[model samples]
Target: MQKQDFYQSLVKQAQALISGERNVIANMANLSALLFTSLEDINWAGFYLVDSPDELVLGPFQGNPACIRIPVGKGVCGTAAHAKETQLVEDVHAFDGHIACDAASNSEIVIPVFKNGEVFAVLDIDSPSLARFDEADRDGLQALVRCFELTLS
Candidate 1:
């Protein structure tokens, strides 16, 4: 299947999995599993919730254990939450201030998950391959996050 079609299908599945589920933790858990299982070449998929102005706490995840806490503006996940924008890194080793929670993760994509117009958490996915995520993944994942945001209201 084409990348766009694959992502669209993933987004639809994400919506179906979390539809009518108001709990953030439960939704995050399901979404993590969904992404981890559906996406190829990915080693990690999970959430880092904004616990404070400068810190993020690990949430539901599927993969090797990750860093328990990350400070804002520190890593890809932290940068996404801090800037409230998506950070797609083709090479984690080249990224400044990268925190290597898993040595196997060579690339990553982090998207901010908003609640009430403010970022509440970040959806983070990692891959062992270089340039694993692309614009299609970003756009589709953003759409999927929008569906999750709806459940918060």
Candidate 2:
């Protein structure tokens, strides 16, 4: 399927999943799996939730073993949390101070999840292809993150 169609289907599935249950972790896990399976060339898709101490604790994810903790200013995920905005890196290696959780990951996108105007978590996706994501992906994934945040509450 085309990427746009795949993303739309994912949004529909997420909405259905959230409507049927109010379990945040379960929902995130499902979403992670969906993104992992649907997106091509993706090495990772997951969430990092903000802990009370202002650190990111690894949440639901689908892929190899991942970093369990991340400070707010480090890595793409952490940078998104610290900036409270989306960080789309087309080339992970070129990003200064990039964290290499998986050397195969060439690109990444991180979207901050907000609750009551504060960042509470981030949705992170990494790809094995350089420039794997673009503006369309940014818009679609940002919309998907909104669904995720709403389902959590």
Best by lDDT: 1
The positional error of residue 20 in candidate 1, measured at the CA in angstroms, is 1.0
lDDT of each: 0.94, 0.89
Backbone N/Cα/C clashes per model: 0, 0
Poorest lDDT segment (10 consecutive residues) of candidate 2: 14-23
Residue-wise lDDT of candidate 2 within 4-110, one digit each (tens)?
78678878877887776777789889889988987888999999999854689999999999999898888898889999999999999999878898888999999
Best by TM-score: 1
Give the lDDT of residue 35 in candidate 2: 89
TM-score of 2: 0.94
Q: How close to the true structure is residue 143 of candidate 2, measured as C-alpha lDDT?
A: 84
Deviation from native of the Cα of residue 132 in model 2, angstroms:
0.4
lDDT of 1 by residue, 28-129 (tens): 999999999999999999999999998999999999999999999998999898888999999999999999999999999999999889999999999999
If scored against the real structure, what TM-score would every candidate get? 0.98, 0.94
